[model samples]
Target chain A: MGKLFAVVVTIITVVSTAIFIAHTWWLPPDISAHGHAIDRQLSETMISSGVLFVLSQLALALFAWRFGDREDGRRVKPFPGGATPMVVFAAVLVGAEILTLTLVGAKVWAGVFQTPPDPNSLQIDVQAEQFAFYFRYPGPDGRFGATHPELINEASENFFGLDPARDTSARDDIVVPTLTIPLNRPIALTLRAKDVNHAFYVPELRIQQDFVPGLTIPLHFTATQTGRYEIVCTQLCGLGHYNMRAYIEVLPQAQFDQWLKDKAAQQ
Target chain B: MRVRDLMLVGGVGLGGTAMMIGRAATPPGATISGKVTFTGTPPKMKPIDMAKEPFCARLHAAAPVLTENVTTGPGDALRWVLVYVSAGDQGSAPATETVRLDQKGCQYIPHVLVVQPNQPLDIYNDDSTSHNIHPLAKVNAEWNKSQPIGAPPIHAKWESPEFIPVKCNVHPWMHGWHLVLTTSHYAVTGEDGAFRLQGLPPGKYTITAWQEQFGTQSQDVTVTGSETKSVSFVFKATPY
Candidate 1:
């Protein structure tokens, strides 16, 4: 029985190690700035974690197998009151990993949220409700019009409660169901929630920011690749949570200009 | 090492401004569009409970039908079927173009809408009751917003690829979908399992169809600028 258990644990460890390596090795190379950072950090942490995990598990298994029925009755030895060095070593490993990651994470957060709005940046106003994200570009003036949530009426074609009659600023404002941006330029987004708290998250970009009601949260990032990436809400807001999706197109400069021209024509 | 080091490595690796080249850089792509319908018998339209959303329930009576009425003939077809174009040569950024999805009579209008990334979506709720738009997207931002009648509409955009489902919490059964694509070329098959898309620069294209209940169907076709090609796809019913 003891031998059987040992064999089983050995197989389990081997399989788990193979699985751990397979899962981590198969991911595509990191491309986004933040995504790459987190990916490398996570990969290193995982490699170390995986090694430690296997070592500890194997140690435990070996001890159990060898001692499972030693009916020889050996006296158990108690850990010395202080194994001070061992205790300190274990504590330092855990606390230090957390501290280091936190510090690195804080810096990444700052990069994502603190950089000043550069003139070369593209600006987008994002309004979140229930389960969807509404993005507004100041249109030609770049000055946002006042929007009253209280006045929204979808059937009457008064969505976003632009109050066009009352707020002339919104008259030229363009309403689009999708979002487009120029490639390579830093993009800043201001987020707001009309009713409840909602989170804006995009996995490929490795960014997730929340939309606070009555408060605007700014999130910024520069696209690294031309291909379209996916952005989804992390917070579970409502039933539509499953179907809430918007499109973000990163166009070349010239095409972007044409899009602006085309959109302006609508007004 | 440090975060800056990480970023330096990432920045160098992800350079080129990630700009969107024209559709020319993208291989040729075909469009697919079709209406979803039912044959033989149509299902009975039952009034769904909008108590949670009495405003919507009060204004609309039968559940909105995008799926063909399948009670009398064939089987339950086209009802809540998600049909979309799946494969195509990638396209440029999402146009400033916008699609409006209205919440009326406790249902989402334009039941099936296909959009590319970076485009805007206007969510409007007309009924006096409140309605929420939630998109369950893993690739794009996941958001939930509620609109009360007499309030402003909620506008949002997608920066990535995702298949979003819209629903009204007030009315549990009220459902709809917002399909976001990374590529600009795509189409949703209609009831007759037929789809059409025009405007091509002439090239080889891959067209795919999606059905919420029927899974996915795909095919490849070639089109020249002055040429129109015929494509057909069928999805046999299967229990998912």
Candidate 2:
């Protein structure tokens, strides 16, 4: 029975390690410039963890097979170097791994979040509501209008509650359901929420941020490719959260300008 | 003399039959009909842009559709106003007919729909694109599902009386309302802003009219048997 148990444990360890190395259910390809660093950090962590897992499982299997029940009444033997060596070994190894991960993780986070956006980056405002997201761009006036909650009527399409009649600056504000930006350019988004807590997650971009009501959070990213990706809400705000998704269209500079022009005309 | 007596008997029998038919034709109930009007200028409805969905945009390329938030018809008659018995002692029963709401042109066919508690609601997506139907109900269980193009319609029923806001997650501009009530006596105003609630028992009841933007207005009314009562509601509009 003990021999069989050792064999089963060995098989389990081998299969799991093989699956981890195969990378079958891995993340999609990183499409952002800063995404490479995040990928590297993830790979390093996985490798270290994978090695630890394999060593521990194999040691357990070896001990079970070597120290099985003996009918010869042999005295039991304690591990070499007693408990102190094993304790010290675990502390040193785990402590070093934790230290390395923390330092690397902090750098990666600071690079993506703490670094200021470029001066010439295009600024866009994002409003997360019950079950949808609306993106607003500063029109030719290069200004955002003040929002009034009372005037926010979805039926009349005054989604942002910009009172054009009273607020002159709001007249040129362009609001659209989708986010479009020029590729290879730094894009900064000011995220705000209307009613409840929500999250903005773009898997390909390796960016995620939360939108808290009454507070505006800023996120900056640059897309290296010109393609369309889905922006899904990760927060469970309401019943419509699952369906709350929008598309991000990254276009060339000239094409993005034309798209803005078309949207402006509609506004 | 015998012929004259026989004719008299036949005439008497015919008169009794006619009286019985007349009584059966008119049930022992009252009716309430009214016009929901608004004073002051209503906010202009902006054109809806379905550019996110190319198919929906192309469907309305020839003629654009306006928002239905505060739709006003001729003579300031408010459309899509729900008028029903807010407070009354009428026994309720689930409607036998299934209420159907269609998603066409990326917009709800009826901007406002009213249903009784536990009434079956059949929602269909008649457009070529997909739609996610989400009903945000606080008192009742909230549910949402995606219906792809040519997919089967969703069959749902609400067990509680609450006002639910329905929206298509895929299409942000698509919004609607579902009023679940316990009373079976209800009416929704058309373009003419006219509604009629018939077969109401004779009693003192409260009639309420609810507009999506202007809120609700209610009044107490007394109904007598076999009578038609006329009522009118005027909502003050704001041009924000």
TM-score of each: 0.51, 0.67
- Report lDDT (Cα) of residue B74, candidate 1: 34
Highest-scoring model, DockQ: 2
lDDT of 2 by residue, A190-246 (tens): 998999999999999999899999998999999999998889899999766776778
Steric overlap count per candidate: 101, 0
DockQ of candidate model 2: 0.26
lDDT of 1 by residue, A1-267 (tens): 666677788789889899877785455434354577667666776776688778877886787787766777784564566578778888999789778767876776676567676666788778777555666777788777798889753322233667765676876676554567777778888888877878877666667788788998878777676655555767777665654545566788788779877776655
Interface RMSD of 1: 14.1
Tens digits of per-residue lDDT for model 1 on B1-240?
A: 111221222223223122122222223433334444443332233333333233544554364322221111233334334433355453545456555566766666545555667677777776666676666677777777768667787878888777776655444445667777766455443333334554455666666666543456566766665555666554444210
**lDDT, candidate 2, at A266:** 66
How much is the lDDT of residue B230 in candidate 2? 93
Interface RMSD (Å), every candidate: 14.1, 3.2
Query: Among all windows of ten consecutive residues in candidate 1 chain A, which has the lowest summed lDDT?
Result: A152-161
